[model samples]
Target: MMIALTILALCLCTCTLAGELFEPQANAQNTKASGATIKADPFQQRGLCRRWAHQSTVKNGTLYMFGGSMLLKQNNTVQEVPNTEFLQLDLAQSFQLSENTVPWQKPKINGDTIPPAFSAGAMYSGKGDFVFLYEGQTPKNLPEQPSSMWGYSLINRTWQMTDRWNHADENFPNRQSRGASVMTSDGNTGFYIGGLRAYENDTFKGWYYGPEEQFTVIDLAAGKKSKMERLPLGQKRIGPNVVYLPIGKKGSLVLVGGTGEYKVRLSAPVQNATKMDGINPDDVRLNPMSQMDTIWIYDIDAGRWFYQTAVGDKPWERKNFCMVAATSDPDSSGNKTHHIFIYGGGTDYMTPMFGMNDKPFDDMYILSLPAFRYYQVKLGDVKPDARQRMTCHVVNNKQMLVLGGHRVNSSETLKDCRWDELNLFDMNTLKWQTEYNPSDPGDSKFIPNPDVIAALGAKTQEPALGWEDEDVKCLFTGICPGEQGIEAQKKRSNARWRKWYIAVGGAGGALIMALIITMLFLRRRRKENKALRYELEQLQLYFQYQTTGEIYSSTGVNNLISDGDAFVSEKVRPMTFGERVKFVFGKKGSNNQEIPTIFDLPSEKRRETEVEKIP
Candidate 1:
């Protein structure tokens, strides 16, 4: 089970770093490396590859991706390599391009500090003009460090490591982060939430209830970060997203879907997720995280947390998925809405059911705020293949810029969006558009979800999540004695529909089928496992006792007999000429040499020879 978990977890880790891992090619310039200047083209800087679990952010009309696992060819062999390349694409140029193009600029870094290969928590700081990356998973072969920090200037094309990058600092002890998400709204201050920390073979590898609620508030401009201790989630989450909404005084951080612990519940289990009868050995670790079970919103100004839920076309709970939020501009009435666009993630184990879904979502969802409802976007004829671990960003307030992800399952066809390295989605038209246009419509408002409107009427019903603190209510409602919904906000005490819905038919079906499958599978698997255990034991004995390099079976004819092999035991039988030739020269690839017996003289011959020396 541990081994299985390790493999799956490692693969997930692989998927993400394989994400932002690509390095952009410097534009026909010379760069310094190892104290020597080298032509950029000769350095083999390239574009993005199929990736996931990458660190990415958009700032100042440019999208930056760094640190991810990517597939690269070295000496004719395809290997999973980490991308340390800084990839950038100008939003204006990309939106104006005509045909398929990989417009990535891999700037020549001017300093020693470089982006880690994968799993680094990162954000783009606008005020400082730097991309700050915090702790990340290093290559296993490399020496592990206490997590540190590094700042890369996109403008000056340099990396910086000062005293602030120290890992020994008591403040930022939560250094090692994997499967975490980082985001910034103002571009100066960033928030990093939910990551597996201090994971190892010795521990549960961050499986269950571990770590105090992970919510590190980073002040990038100050070169410091603080782990907020006030609010704690009941369970630890992996790969969760922290989206900043400028709602309350200091704003609210919206905590979206990721893997939660202990509680095994689902809003609507995907058909693929429900197929597994019991824990498949290969996917035991992935099952719990595949359900979209919860959402929590934290009010920074009030220092409190409020539970929230979504209705209408909700996505099945999943992990290793990516999402980005785009708030609609305020309308004529000063009414605004927030839209969280979600795409591509792995589902529950499905080998028993339909055969594949390890990276199984090609669908998309829009969770609009204020209305607080979900709306599934209708895709055009062309859409991406099922994939996961990719990072996405909202660009130009109109299109979603998706970068670096892979189809973990080879059975599914891998589709690059028009261009090979990136995908562009038009939020206005709800289409996977091939042509990029700068003058196209902007993402100014939320297109209505009729299903949501029908379910909750025009106004959003209030959440029954009664607040313990008056301050929190005020923060949520945006006024003292806050009771009125902030422009159709769902803060009313008696809103009919529940926060999170467990679809009766779907949940019941999943529960019943799961129980039935578990019972039967347990019964059958027990017998089979017993037999398998016995067979494995016997094979272990055979390999341990029957095979040895000193024996005639494993080694060639042991003519240089040790005292143990002197006797003519059947196990030590001599080989035929062909067998000897095959063993020594061909199949066995051993040296062919005649063994000289220094003590070949018989007893009589020994006595006769010794007579002369009998003094």
Candidate 2:
């Protein structure tokens, strides 16, 4: 009897797998025409090779991407390499790919090129007609702090050095990674905030020891910057999404979810202390700071900071996420609002759903300012997989394009690899479109016009005809079929096997029939077992709550505690800043319940609750 049941379970599992195998094919067949396909390649290199943490900005009708890390085959082993070349894709022509008409172009960027790249900050200044590049690490494992800012001209197609905008007191901005940068609406001021850094004076400390608390503001009009402003005391952040929102006379720089350093633990002291002991790993201690789930807003005009307590389902603490203000976001009145879109990031702070640093999110979230409301956008089944360090840009008012990111699956070993294809999310339609690039677009390389080159006093190099050289082939693998193309190919390749399975299914129909009858009985039994298991879990949770008085909410909302006296209102009102801070920081309610504070009450006016003893 036991053996028969085991075989029955195996057959059911196989049936489930078989059903899943055809799901993609079914969806692909349904949406094949609507799916975007490519006629020409857009990437510099191919075969799913990607560069991470590069900066991209849209200007006029072209999208400019520059600098980052790419994984390349180096002497049989794949290694992460820094890329300094500049690539541009014509937005007007990107919708349709063509072999005859090259859409992606690269201009010969000569004269004071970007420092050997690592992930850096880059933004387009609408007023300047130039893109500004700022603080990032170098190939030699040092921070690149050029005295002057590097600016690329869209009008003249030339690179020119510009004034260095830094804190007058600090002299230079701290070198860091995953920091957020934004320019104001007027384009006369820019801001850089929240980066991961190690103490420069101490070499023995481990990497990611701390986060930079201060932010630098640059006055593009004045050709200088104000003094560095420190973050709230005791609050250091890295990888936070910072954006500027202009109000009547001034603006606010809003800082969103980020990771910070919490504590460090030192190992036992070594006997017979020596000079090297201080630098030993056992002696040096470090711990990742807890994720600062709270949101902080800096009023640039007032030179003050305040907490923004949101009122909806808040996003979890994440790092390496890309955020861009949705200039096209309309409010209820059909007016532009300060709404920021956050997408694709890793949640290392989340309790190990799979394992450590293994969970990346594919979901998108919106944070509306002043209102400080948060809600996740439900993108249909068609969306990019979980990834981080991607460049997401808002374009054409209602479209978001994501390109070049890294993902580490649970089954795969961790490495610095990037996804090659670009994905677009239609804000209005809420549809996802993955652009296909079959081969490197013929015009991947460019030589500036002779007249322009002579005027700039720089020589131009001829572009490579193709990936014909052996070394070039090794460095940049040829393009790979995109996800859609690969799916179609896979279906065709498996057609014969699928036919065989169908023929065998005919012969095994009797056996399948008998198994189906058995499955009917087993299905009912499984449901009963599931219900029993759920009941057991609830009972255990009930006992645990009774003993500890702490009950967690899986919805990512506020946790509820049970003493049988809590009154959870059917309609919970919005909470104020003081009440939110007091409740979120772990104060009990007036009725000894773990509920959020009321909107209209001040902290001093609310009476403290007495502890109820549970026996």
Candidate 3:
């Protein structure tokens, strides 16, 4: 019975520890009612708007934004602004609607831990609690530094400079800024897709898609000295997004729509090219397709690339769109596919020579995978402004949080644009809700619309499909540690069970032995007490006979023996189960001495002090 109680107590402790790791689902319901914006009275006013090339990622229930060029209006002209500030938004604090305002905290940076300003793509390593900032364009005024990769640890709240991999170096591929990058499930391999080269005074030197579509692969674990390999791709991609699909033996990488390749050569004159009227006779410019409707898939395990023809209604070709896998479902055969949601982006952007322009989009589309199908979500009354280079994050698989991106306002051109407002799209309701008003221009709470809530009363469900399971080589074999084939996993599981059984059996045997030993000791102590009592009784009878030459009453002798037995039992009580278990499992005394039994306890009677006796 004591063993059962001990096991119950241990189980309770284990469950309590596990509960602290994950929060309860009650917050999900509260979030739905409160929307996404956090409003408090005392809030920090942080300007997250008008920043370009910045990246955002969610960690520890907080949103972290890093590295971007700020566009500030100075002296009636837009100027490229650089700063040494990093931003983090605490979701828990923001959700407290009781406060009138919500504030985002900027962590303190000591010395040169984080560079003042750089424009680049950043990725969050959830496994390591680190955020990697890739090399990107920097302002001209800043000191020229070697191209390098950097890391910021969320756990340590510190930034450290990592190894340098120069894009201009012959060893590396073309320089990338608006390119697509995605880390493998293991967070070791990073695949960088196509990006345009830096525009020189008169020409673009290394266009990623100039006859040769190439991508660079980096081993993130190796840091700066990591092997940089440039490999050929199917076609050139500019401003595309890559999604890692972790399903099959080796998961696949999918590249969504982007501006396809355009080639330029200085060797020959080009005809029918835009803005070639007064250009040099030797220069030729190729006009790239504004947008691509094609979707590219790369099989990581097989080192192969394939395209699937999506049958349903499809979205337009776009670039810099926010695309994320909101959720996934598995079939009866254990084959899983994800549901991807693509949001607003631009359609057309030309090279500097031809004059740059972008046609933004505000539509949303859902691409169901493995089946390669598309479903357009119609926004009835509300729609987000058309913007590109913006970031969208999924919130609990129910809503998408849209953050900062620049767009041409009614009175402004592309060069002079304003930041878009924070928007939230409900996946279930198919409605758009304003989250934070960067304009303020203050943090404001959004009340839910009654009509939209009524419309979303019925929950949406995904259609089921039957699929055939094919034998595929495991691409993620070592990527995810300990994840293996069914047979191997089963064998390992069986071994674990065997070891656990052995340990439990050994502990149980020890506990039983401890119980038996305790019982024997108690019995021996009782016998010794009885013998001592008998000896004392004999001595007491001798004393009585010597004093009065008369035998003591039989009743008096019985009472004396009874009193002795009670005293010994009170002094040496039996041990509780908890005490026995501790004796068996707890560390031994000095010199590895055996645990003391109840009989070994001090037998001294306490002497009352004067104050205690009076009290």
> Which model scores highest in lDDT?
1
Candidate 3 segments whose C-alpha is farther than 4 A from its true place? 1-49, 74-77, 95-102, 140-145, 167-175, 186-188, 199-213, 220-234, 262-287, 290-293, 331-337, 349-356, 409-421, 435-615
- Residue 570 lDDT in candidate 1: 27
lDDT of 2 by residue, 359-390 (tens): 56688876654344555677878777778777
Candidate 3 per-residue lDDT over residues 473-551, each given as its tens digit: 2331222224343345456656755675577786775665577568746754664454334333433433343344333
RMSD of each: 26.8, 31.1, 36.6
Ranking by lDDT: 1, 2, 3
After superposing candidate 2 on the true structure, give the runs of residues whose Cα lies further than 4 Å from its correct spot.
1-44, 73-77, 96-103, 112-114, 140-148, 160-174, 198-213, 221-226, 262-293, 327-337, 349-358, 409-420, 435-615
By summed lDDT, the worst window of 10 consecutive residues in model 1 runs over 606-615
For model 3, what is the C-alpha lDDT against the true structure? Answer: 0.49
Q: How do the residues 400-423 of candidate 1 rate in per-residue lDDT, one tens digit apiece?
A: 777766675534443432224467
Is candidate 1 or 2 superior in lDDT? 1
Best by TM-score: 1
Better of 2 and 3 by lDDT: 2
- Which model, 1 or 3, shows the larger TM-score? 1
